[model samples]
Target chain A: MKPIGLKDLFVIFLKAGLAFGGGLGILAVLEEEFVTKRQALTREEFLTDYALGRIVPSGTMSALAADFGARFGGFPGSVIALTAMVLPAFTLSVSLSAAYVYLAGTPVLALLPLTILPAALAFIVAAALRLGRDITIPSVEALLAAAAFIGSLVFRISPALLLVGGGIVSMVILAFTERAENPA
Target chain B: MNPLQVALTIMVLNILTFGNGPALVPLLEERFVTMEGILTVDQLLYAFAIARVMPGPANAYVASVGFFLNGLLGAALAMVAIQLPAYLMLPLLRLHERFSDVAGVKRFTRGLTATSVGLIFASTVSIGRNAITSLTAAIVFVLALVMAYLLKWNPLLSLALAALAGLALHAAAPSL
Candidate 1:
């Protein structure tokens, strides 16, 4: 495929950002635009970017947009793509924040928490299941997962520390396992 | 609570978690609600509600959190802080050959991701304790799970149904 212009990159990501339902929703939009509609990237290329986005420590959609931008237009393109994708939600969040602050005491808006919070919890449960689907039961990964749950919920440890520490320990164990198996 | 603190908190959270916007909920609640006392549980729920209804990443709600704490400047800083870490991914992606070649990298990601899943569940329990205050809400929670998970309804549709149920239930009893 030919190189995509920065303007086109911005427009594509801007459209993707307008998708609701968060990250999964945005990914569908991006696949449609980049792979099927514009043919800017092949299906396999889009999937690779999606996988790369998963491992990076950022929102998957935002990271994917940056990667696509860097591919098409370099660093500047990357910045522009990410900005365009994030702008819509940021604007809405600020606007909603203003509304919530100003109208919080009213009875009508008070219903939001009663209605929304429960659903949000349900959403979180589903998200957790999706994230944990690959882990086998009674395994080392399960043990680490259980430890994280207890550390965050019971012991009240800093989640940032838990993630970093867990990742380093997991890497070392994996390295040792690999060395032991190969005997190199 | 100050501009610098808000920026740093958001930037740190973004750099640690890998996934969609909702992935930030555990760390975000830990910082703002449990640790700092910046916002109450209900306030954060309002932000999450608005985020789910709005377009873009759910993490965009960090702007709402910032706005609640310090107004427009906080919101702007939050957005910038959240987006900045995506650039960090650019460098890692640029080194994709070496990055993917390392077996340890994949294992490390697996471990981090599993832990994140656990944290998310922990936050769900924490948030649920505060949010599920009534029978109506409990019912809606079950209905939403069924719709969004089993039936595979769009979250927007499920949330809309939830809002309607809340209004009807609140009106019928006015006591819940």
Candidate 2:
């Protein structure tokens, strides 16, 4: 494998950031450009790439960019796509961070938090609901979720315990189900 | 502390943990609570509230907290540090299809997802405990929950309504 240099990394990051900050709509445009017009990959390939990206750690868009880049131009392509995805957001975040400090302690600053907190809570609740809808929880799974919720809320159980317990239960259930289905 | 070191630490934290961003909160609190001294627990709660209200990613609030500490430089450092690792790691993953498809890796991810949900749940309880002081606040919480779960109302809109209700209640009973 060719060694990636500092200059190459920087260029890739810069390009990915720019593309990412351009927003999801722009991503759709890029998909059409590269996947459709360029015939780099088919729609099924693109969808699989994106699904894998979402299922894996990190942001879905960044993952997709990396997958596409790797496919198109090997390591260099992956670097370019990742850079394009992140650069825009990175630049904006840096600029905003600088401006935000200057504006601190103002009434606007106070108001900003006031508006943001409720929205954030709402987002959290919505996310939980969305996740719940997606997963096919058996009665045991539902019981586990309820137990975790109650343990966290009522008994002050550590979140770590709930997570570990859930994992163990799921693994055991999966193992038993697999064994039962394929009994010799 | 060197600005670059600070940035790197945040970047590393973001990468090591899953991408939920807020996952770094407890760890960040443990690290910076003493060194920075600018963010009191109360202020941290307030900042968290503000981040929640905002339309964008919850981790974006790190900028607000960083700004509170060492001004623009701090905020810039914090944002870069938090996001940089993810930016760097995503591309790296593309090259190793086998690495991505490993069974152990999938199990680890599934475990992480479960942990993240639990953490979020814990955070909700903590946040709710802090914010829901009065009868009106409790009402707002229940309403928000119903709207989110049952009515399927958009979260941002529900939040806006809750904020409006809070503001209106505060105005009506200034003494309370």
TM-score of each: 0.90, 0.65
Could you give the CAPRI-style class of model 1?
Answer: medium
lDDT of 2 by residue, A41-61 (tens): 678667666656544444455
For model 2, what fraction of the real interface contacts is kept? 0.15
Total backbone clashes of candidate 1, pairs 3 or more residues apart or in separate chains:
0
Global local distance difference test of model 1 = 0.81
TM of chain B, each: 0.91, 0.72
**Poorest stretch of ten by lDDT in candidate 2 chain A:** A17-26
* CA deviation > 4 Å runs, candidate 1: A1-3, A42-45, A176-184, B98-100
- Assess candidate 2 and give its lDDT: 0.53
DockQ of each: 0.68, 0.25
- Model 1 chain A, poorest ten-residue lDDT window? A108-117
C-alpha RMSD between model 1 and the true structure: 2.4
Per-residue lDDT tens digits of candidate 1, residues B27-51? Answer: 8899989889988888787787777
lDDT against the true structure, per candidate, is 0.81, 0.53
In model 1, residue pairs whose N, Cα or C atoms come closer than 3 Å (at least 3 residues apart or on different chains), thus clashing, are none
